[model samples]
Target: MIDDDAVGGTRSQTDVVIGGIKQMLTSGALVPGSRLPIEKDLATQLGVSRGSLREGVRALATLGVLETRQGDGTYVTALDPGNLLSPLGFLADLQQPAHAADLLAVRRILETESVALAATRLSETELAELEAILAAVDDSLQADAEMDLESFIDADTRFHRTIARASGNPPLAAVIDTLVGRTFRARLWRAISHRGSVRETQAEHRAILDELVRRDSERARIRMAVHLLGVEEFSAAHADEDPEAS
Candidate 1:
């Protein structure tokens, strides 16, 4: 329980409630999956009204720090990277298409390093899987027919995501996944407006995968950077293009 004197400082009651719970967490009084104390008792312990405590709890729930079961009670969450960073995708989705260049810039920095790591860490089976993804891309591009936008996009998403996961870094992979999901519409818009853009991107994916297969970390990083930089430049040039329309 929080100290009685923990509340009633210059801070708002909600802050007090939040801070008290934080203190309990840090002091090992709480752990992942620990059930919170009863509402009235916790309210009294924090020296705050039950309403204020509820407000604080709601805020924590939004942040993925806690979960309230339908009839069981509130408890601490596992606090994994996916849970904590889940809000990032939601926020990124709300940004204007004009901001895609900004998002891609960040993506480039993270993915370049991730690909470098993946060059050394990926398994033989994973390498074969990547080749298969690009093989599908090749088939998609070989025909004179109009591109299947959804098929191309799915392949594009899987290729990069496989590399990110192979980097052997869970948190990094989670963040890259979020960024990739957010940038989907911008990529689709580019493919629609820029003739042969899909072919260009597919070629770049081949280059990156080739470097990874060779286990050349430096070249893999370079290839990945160059690939994303092209997308960033294209997105930046068309700042007014609303990808949502595609």
Candidate 2:
């Protein structure tokens, strides 16, 4: 039910230009991470104005179909559905409180299954990666270096992603990747609100790692669920706290 006429797609020229771009992405003429022709060149080739070309690119970028580098040219993003799942994640974050919990429930379902699978299938390399991530978590917690919200969240994400990777399915890893996009950043911000939460997360992370190292998948999965549930509990308990407070 898209009204092409409403979204800068009214003109015949605009429609043709958008159609061609869609065809290119769909037909694989433009692959992920591949740079597109320069804007002027693409505009000329598609018989559209440079402004229109930029508009199209901006739209695609918003959809995670493309990424624009400030000093460099634009390129297609990894077309993995997981890569494009951020919008849904963002929407979920803004949804009703109950809906947010629902999303978390779905995440728990996926991750619990993954941890069980990982126990049966992880390769030595994958196991080592998990250990490495755990080591990084320890280092980050112990470091005197000031970790900003972004660094903390990235490190936290790497921790979970390593576990997902150890689960031995790229698709499962991707699912967790998508699931984290919404709330992981907020969780870091929440942790920064209370000094104690940071210490708590670090201790909990070690416990989860210990469970994994013991090759007890059930314990690992349960620990992970408890860890996340603790966050949910703590966040709920401090709903009125300032997320930006140091």
Candidate 3:
């Protein structure tokens, strides 16, 4: 269903801005490759102020509509998947860093019980995969200085994905993957990564693996929960020390 905001604005300003943009888009005046007029010019044309015009343009950009270039002008970006999806990462890297551990806490609550039980019911083949992931994690840890941020992140992600996959629930793992995703590497590297971060995280993973290997679902679940909670506590303390968050 189309949103009310998409059409039938309650106010004249919204109506003028939205209606004008839609008109230009539907008409050939602003084709896919065409450059948007300057903000002042657009405001004049749309019978709105520059601020409102810019706001409307940003809203459309959020919906994968426009692209702004540095020193160059704003143009209608290609609506291809690559162009459209480029905003996801940039949005993820928004200048204001959120309390990451709080987000991780929610993820832990969602995944702990499920992953633990999944580990208990894992098949021999699945166990082999988990073993392989641990091996890779260890390999990366041993070469920590040589490994780039992405490499370390990939190894760690594989470790988590292995446990999530063993849970036998695709949707659960996918959600977990998205939550503790690519942005997590940047956060973890900055916050928790001292010289000993890898060793500390490796030890934590080992403890989690020990409980899972013994099929102690309760202990495994609690262990993972505590680990994620530790991250929350760490981040909170870090925020306390930072003037920005305070």
Quote each prediction's TM-score. 0.86, 0.58, 0.56
Worst 10 residues of 2 by lDDT: 1-10
* Top candidate by TM-score: 1
lDDT of 3 by residue, 1-246 (tens): 122553465555545676687678788678787898887787877777677777777777775777778788777766554435445444334424456556666677867866686768877776677677667767875766455555666767777777887787765665666666667556655655654566666677788887878888888898888877776677666653432322
Global lDDT of each candidate = 0.84, 0.69, 0.67
Which candidate order results from sorting by lDDT in descending order? 1, 2, 3
Two-way TM-score contest, 1 vs 2, winner: 1
Deviation in Å, model 2, residue 109 alpha carbon: 2.9
Prediction RMSDs, each to the true structure: 2.8, 6.2, 8.8
Q: Which scores better on TM-score, 1 or 3?
A: 1
Ranking by TM-score: 1, 2, 3
How do the residues 1-246 of candidate 2 rate in per-residue lDDT, one tens digit apiece?
122553565665545566767778888888888998898888887777788778878878887888999889998888776667656666545644434455566677778778777776777776777677667756776784444555666666777777777887777777777766637456535544455555566677778777776778899888888877766665555555555453
lDDT of 1 by residue, 1-246 (tens): 454444336677888888888988999999999999999999998888999999999999998998999899999999777778877886567667678789889999999999999999999999999999999878767774457777777788889889999999989998988866735544545534445678888889999988998999999999999998988888788778766554
Off by over 4 Å in 1: 1-10, 143-145, 186-193
* TM-score of structure candidate 3: 0.56
